[model samples]
Target: MPLSDHEQRLLEQMERALYAEDPKFASALEGTGLRTRTRRAVYGSAAGFVVGLGLLMGGLFLHQQWVSVGGFVLMLAGAVFGVTAWRRIPRLALVDPRTGAPVAKRRKRGGSLVDRMEQRWQHRQEQQGRGGGF
Candidate 1:
């Protein structure tokens, strides 16, 4: 689900605070570098696969068994390399830059979705009890 307006504002505020606290760390954790490398890897792998296909066809036409086997191995290697690289790219940076520890490990409360929802509900109740808006 999309974030509510308040949640969006809170997220922006947190991002601003992170940048203010450590601009260098924040930028390093940013995903653009990882994305660029992954993109290059994907493109390179695709090119390799194509070249391997040509080799396979050429070997077949020339009745060269070893060349065909090599081409097949090349194609498999390219696919495996691309897949491993893609999987290695992280979706989120959850580490505390200064501490070098995962954010989840530092939190007192549980980090599961259900636990988070319960915390939110409790927070909402407390706010409402105090005549405050979330």
Candidate 2:
């Protein structure tokens, strides 16, 4: 279920309290990131997908049975990643020159810096509406 306005407001307040209590912790929480536990599943699977794409293309053009088999194997690998680690990685954009992330941009729409960021994220998420749990 989507959060109610009250829940959203409460979350905002809690975020501010958290930042005030410990800026370091707040900074740590600022960006969505993949946990180390999910890294191999994500990156390894991505590599597999790329491999599969290349192999599938080669198999079609070169009439190579081995390449076709490899492509299917890589597709299976990518599926494993989709089910596990894929959800953990945040959708990220090109890095900002100043802070190496688009989020580092100073301009925002809400009262506090963090609130503005949250608002921006929420807006974009709503606009995209991928229907994912993230």
Candidate 3:
């Protein structure tokens, strides 16, 4: 579930405290986010694939099996490189550059079904205690 306003404020306070306490550690933890890294990988892979294609075509025209095999290897390597980079792209904590503090990314997955049910049950109990009707 999305954080309540109160929770968000509390989290911001905690982040500020962390930055104030040890900025060096916070900065060290920060990194270029996944977008930049993925873009670089894409560009590199595209270039490699094109070069490999060219080499393959040249080898076919020249009737050199070894050259064609080398080109195929290059293409395979390029694909592997791209896939590895994509898989390894870390989920970076969004950080404020000026303060060198971590920022919270919104949670993609809400609480599990059981957790949600429990929360609703607790909320109902609280409301009943306050004399609120069903």
Q: In TM-score terms, which candidate is top?
A: 1
Residues 1-134, model 2: lDDT tens digits: 97886985677666556666665666566563444546766777888888898898899789998898899888887977756776775533223223433333245444788888999889888877966534
* lDDT for predicted candidate 3 compared with the true structure: 0.75
Residue 34 displacement in candidate 2 (angstroms): 3.7
Candidate 1 lDDT score at position 98: 58
Candidate 2 at residue 13, lDDT?
A: 64
Worst window of 10 by summed lDDT in candidate 3: 92-101
Q: Which has the higher TM-score value, candidate number 1 or candidate number 3?
A: 1
lDDT scores for all predictions?
A: 0.76, 0.67, 0.75
lDDT of 1 by residue, 18-130 (tens): 76678677868677688789989988887888888878888999999888888888898888888887787765544445564445523344668998999999999999999
lDDT of 2 at 80: 77
lDDT of 3 by residue, 2-97 (tens): 789798678777656666777667556655555677869977987897788778988999999888888888888888888887777765444574
> On a 0 to 1 TM-score scale, where does candidate 3 land against the true structure?
0.47
Q: For candidate 2, what is the lDDT?
A: 0.67
- After superposition on all C-alphas, the RMSD of every candidate to the true structure, in Å, is 11.9, 13.4, 7.9
